[model samples]
Target: MESQESHRIVVTLAQKARDGADAQQLADFIVSSWQTIEASLSPIIGQRSVATLYKRSFYLASREHPWLMDMHEGMQTTVNLAALKAALLERTSAEIAAGAGAALQMFYEALTNLIGASLTERLMRSVWADLFPVPTQENSA
Candidate 1:
């Protein structure tokens, strides 16, 4: 079992990892760290709900725009986990910010590919659309 603080740090690092690190590196980190996040949230949310929330968040985050699309383009890149862990430990906010967008794109791509497009699309549509409500035909018509 992982500590909550460690999980939070991992989540933050995973978010940063998406900024500029290699897609595979970020993907691997997400995969490993997911257990921590899941564990941390499990008691509060229940396993199924926590899993669903994670899927939704990842889907929505990944599909926000073209950067993520580009990230998906290189989804097969293998991550050097040691290097990634080091980068997460040492990388600055500016550096992270610079590559974070692209990393997130890649993360989304990897996730969508692993999880399937339909599920990813449904998660994105349900979670993100609620936050940033797309105008419906009723509104336009």
Candidate 2:
């Protein structure tokens, strides 16, 4: 069974990925997030594997969000983030959030299944850290 921590991690990543941007800016956020994830995982799993997994995640997500198929179809390369961003630009903020979040959640779950929770969490945490700052502990009064 999936842990709540895993679900939380996926949700947090998707929320933070938007970085408080409006709909017009969401494409940038999504592309940037995907690039970071690709970079982080490619080294460990091989670029081909990362691309494959990325596509698979989207494919699975598209079953529920059929609009995602348009985005996936626009991808010329295995992981054509430019195409994804373009497709995202055509969508509204709510659609972007829902579809992107679903895809991201699927990707995280797939990674956890393939590599085990421990390694997936470590790698994903690295991606999260690279994209967002971690609050530091302040001195107690």
Candidate 3:
């Protein structure tokens, strides 16, 4: 269901991750991160060129977005990732001054699309999971 709350949900998950949350929360963050990407870019880039746009956006976004930077480092890029990132990442002075957060969010979504969510989910489990300890009764105590 689309949101009807009349207010957008900003990335609280990033701050949560920074503060050290549980694996479930991290998983939520991961899913939300992809959602941020899709929601931001899918309309503008469209389906036909989405993959290309994702690559371009991921590369560009990773440069500025801290949360995305982690995912970007682990990504296995091809020549296409390089060329596309370069070509499409040239934002105007006004666009940059306005802030690159929106662009980075779209690109991060593109990275997930480029890499496939399954692989990214696996990575989250294997890599990012350690950053946040899974909550247990013991930990809660």
Candidate 4:
């Protein structure tokens, strides 16, 4: 199903963000990715809706990784990127990957449910073009 594909995209993006990242770099990448996603989605869904989805996703992810709640405490109309980045810096790579990936997957599922999978895919693909790279053709000798 398209929703499944959308989830894959979210997972792939998270993996890409985590790849080759040190703790500081990983936190920067995670926070930057969220900011990019928020910028892309907010106009279409409204900032408040995006914020709600973010909060919901973070809350759901925090059930599995309670440290995530620290980032949620001071959030308002949007995620506190600084808080999230700080929290991420304190986590191991595996925890960062799992928690960030889970939150993103939840957000994608919720977004797809709200906007339909087709639009969500289009929007996300545009926002994260690097994740769905076009393969280059190879010439045989």
- How do all models score by TM-score? 0.33, 0.77, 0.30, 0.78
Candidate 1 lDDT, tens digit per residue, 58-105?
335445432322322322223233443444444444343334433433
Model 2 stretches with alpha carbons more than 4 Å out: 1-6, 9-20, 73-77, 130-141
Winner by TM-score between candidate 3 and candidate 2: 2
Top model number, TM-score: 4
lDDT of 4 by residue, 1-141 (tens): 335554554455455554656667666767877898888888888888888889888887799889887655656787677778878888887678778877777787878788887787788886656533332233111
**Colliding pairs, model 4:** none
Candidate 1's displacement at residue 5, Å, is 12
**What is the Cα-based TM-score of model 2?**
0.77
Off-target runs (Cα >4 Å) in candidate 4 are 1-20, 131-141
Candidate models: Cα lDDT each? 0.42, 0.72, 0.39, 0.72
Q: Write the per-residue lDDT of candidate 3 for residues 24-98, one digit (tens) a residue.
A: 444444444444444544565454354555446545656554333333343332213333233223433223222
Q: Cα lDDT of model 1 overall?
A: 0.42
lDDT of 3 at 96: 29
Candidate 2 residue lDDT tens string, 1-141: 665444554455446444565666766767888899888888788887888778877898899889888655544336888778887888777678778877877888888899998888788887766653342343111
Ranking by TM-score: 4, 2, 1, 3
